[model samples]
Target: MMFQLQIARIATAPLPVWIIWGLGLVTALLLFLSVLLHELGHSLVALHEGVKVRSITLCLFGGIAQTERDCPTAMASLRVAAAGPLVSLILSGLLLGFFPTTKSIHPLLGNLFGQLGALNLVLALFNLLPGLPLDGGLIIKALVWKITGSQRRGIQVANTTGRILSLTSIFAGIWLFLRGGGLSSLWLVMLGCFGLGATRNQSQILALQQVLRDLQVADAVNRRFRVLEDDQPLRRLSQIRLSSTADQRPANWVLVCRAGRWIGYLDDQPLRDLPVQQWDCQVVANHVRSLDELSCISDRAPLWQAVRALEHAHDGRLLVKNAAGIPCGTLDRCDLGEAVLHKLGVALPETFLAASRRQNAYPFGLALSQVVDSMTATDLTEDSV
Candidate 1:
């Protein structure tokens, strides 16, 4: 509605109210399309560089291209980062070029073309600002990576610059608002706050990347799980649960074995259905699941990989395997979260930890997947830190 009003106010060739509104709607859609195309430019270049594009999202702030991984090299990053703004600049030029021709047809049409062209130009230039969460910031990262051989350092510089730029934008917006600049001023203020928030989020991700660098799955492996022979009676399983602590409690799901080979697992949930008298009648094999169906991760692999596995796992848990390809223990969402927070020097509250253990999930819904992606993109490693 605001856009339509803005468009109506801009119309000068004396057009009907409905026609002006229609044109305004079209202009709004075209603007969104322009943002989509801008993101597509980045995604296409990322794909060409052997990176998989997961999704492209159009949000209130702008468009974002979520890729599975980062480019292989600095030059590749530069190419991918520059592609979006380059496409926007080209679009601006083309639209502006067509403006005169359209204006000859109708003033309203000309106005639409002119507005779109100018906005695209602004989009290109605005995104070119050298700061984190922006194309220009990434360009800066690529350059610094090429020059100093350290992407982490590049990220630090970019983040700092982003904070400064965001603050400046906020202050500028406030000045504009005080001078009666209205909605445009508020837009700038909101954009500034958004950018500031994005920069801080990236900073936290970088910190997590530091925590995960060169860390292995074995470091965070939880050994609280029990292994039970398939022939073992449910009564025997019940006897083992007499003594447990918060940190040493046995996992609810225990690994099942048959003839010295892992067969499946048994969940404690179903055991509650039977009476105590039936405990001796049921064997572990009665409720066994196939071990092959479980999501397994190598104990020696990077911890980040385990985090990724947990992120995609339906049950949010993984069966960890040792060097001999034998099941060692398990790593769940809580375990991974505890490990990460431990490294970051942050302690989880007992209540939160208890809740997470009860639900078998990360504490406070921490998003390790996003942090892992950022870590992968920045080439963060132990040596880099």
Candidate 2:
């Protein structure tokens, strides 16, 4: 994840000696407090929902309460989301009650408080917009989930609504921009763009999930593969890859060949740290591991289950074998992602998958599964696919 800091936080910094420090300090403090309170709304609700509050970030975009886990139900999600805006609304109301009109206090303090109160009110209202990745969208998602009895379906509905809302917001922002609405209009356009990007990510995730639901390792596994031998040097194995044709890349493990029969697999970690120049000289057989140390599953296992295994093991790939203990094929995280993308009808080039595999990209298998499940549910419902 990218590191982010709240724009409201900058005010906490000491001002330059030459500037009007008092005014800057006062404005900064007020903005910080308001943003913090708004985020607290979300944190408190999430805590109530049995979700861990990771952090509350009060950035330029306002407050974001990061949670350790997603709420269990739509209602829980809604409540957690609604908490922040509700807090903001309550704060705004309190401010209003304290000063019916910002008429009596010093101009600076009064204006600051009034602005903070109004911003909170706006925050509450804006978050109530029923499009995804937003508080309002979460509410809609929860409602849809309640009605549909599927969280994935709710996400699809919410995401579709989010796209529609985002597009409309973009068009309106554009119109405002053309009509001389200034910087605020520009900000609106940017926000719409952000919404669009988030929607795309959600759509991709859903697609992958659907594919996982439909696929089984049995369908994709190649039954013929070599396993690492225990006695061979890492350098010798590296040479085999160097001499292979276009179809073969260096297998991470070579089959332990004993009397021309497969016995066990070898560990490849020792070879990983060796210098290229020493490739053919070192023995790798001593570094080999028995079959029990590795997690192997039959080819007929569901792709989702396999993915979960791969994730838990923290390995780049899993070895697929048949019921007879014969090495069948391997499932790399990248292969799963590519397969998911293919099912989604996304036209990613084969080279991208290959490159990503070589680079060892992070596993998004679980995310893909979730997305596919959501899309499948949505498609069945005819309301939002």
Candidate 3:
């Protein structure tokens, strides 16, 4: 509807309704295409720097390019961040320059070119404002990273600046609204809110990442597993279950051994499949999985490594091993979250922990996978430098 009104205003003379609507549709598509091109510029530069582009998504706010990993150096990050705005600026220049030539051919074409060019210019300039989640913020992050030689410190600076800017923008929008600036002012408020929300989330994630870096996988391990002989009859499972209690519950996972050496694991499916009558005849040997099939993590590794490994695992679980390379226990997203909260001196109730475990999610609904990936990438970059 806004596009329709804008198109009607742009039309110098009365035209067919169909033609007006068609022009509006074309204009909208072209504007979005410009945004896509801008994001593409960033993706291409990142690719050239050996970063894999995961996806490019165009949204109502704008477009974003997600990379598989961070750039390995400050210079590479700067280049990747600047490419989008640079593309926008170039497009603006080309369109604005071509508008005059179109004016002599057709008035509508001239208006379209003029508006598009001006919009692109605004897009470029607006995104150049220094704040997190924006191209300019990334540039600032790169500069700080280069100067301090620490990506975490760079993120802290950028995020703090972004939060300040977001608050200022929100207030400015409210002032404008109070002064009768209307819907335009509302857009400003919305943008500011979005920025504030994004920055705050990033801040939390940063804090979590720092906690993970300071801790080890052993801190999050739950010794709720049992080691069973591969040759044991399936009836042993029923006995273990009957002997378990609330405080002394049996392991959810049962590791298998053959000839006193670790072999595989007993999956839950077979336990559910065999009835009481067949349990005595069935053996754990045939139902055991190979050791190589499990996702394993070392207790000596930092917690962030376990987070990343679990995020990529099919079951969202890890078999944890001690410093001696012997599997000691298991860790899941909930267990890891408990460790993090415990480190922060925050205690959760048993009910919340139980719910999180059932849902197979982190406590308090925290999302740590992406944060781990990002922080780990930054560590790699710092190590290389």
lDDT values, one for every candidate: 0.82, 0.67, 0.83
lDDT of 1 by residue, 179-258 (tens): 99987898778878988998998888787777676678888897767778999898777776654454543355578888
Model 1 regions lying over 4 Å from their true place: 1-14, 59-61, 98-106, 179-183, 225-235, 242-301, 309-330, 373-383
lDDT score of model 2? 0.67
- Candidate 3: clashing residue pairs, number: 0
- Between which residue pairs do clashes occur in model 3? none
In the range 57-127, model 2's lDDT, one tens digit per residue, is 77643667877667777788878778877887998887766553553654434555665677678778877
Candidate 3: deviation at residue 55, Å? 2.0
Best-first order by lDDT: 3, 1, 2
Q: For this target, which candidate reaches the highest lDDT against the unseen true structure?
A: 3
- Candidate 3 residues 311-338, lDDT tens each? 7777778889887767888999889999
On lDDT, who's better, 1 or 2?
Answer: 1
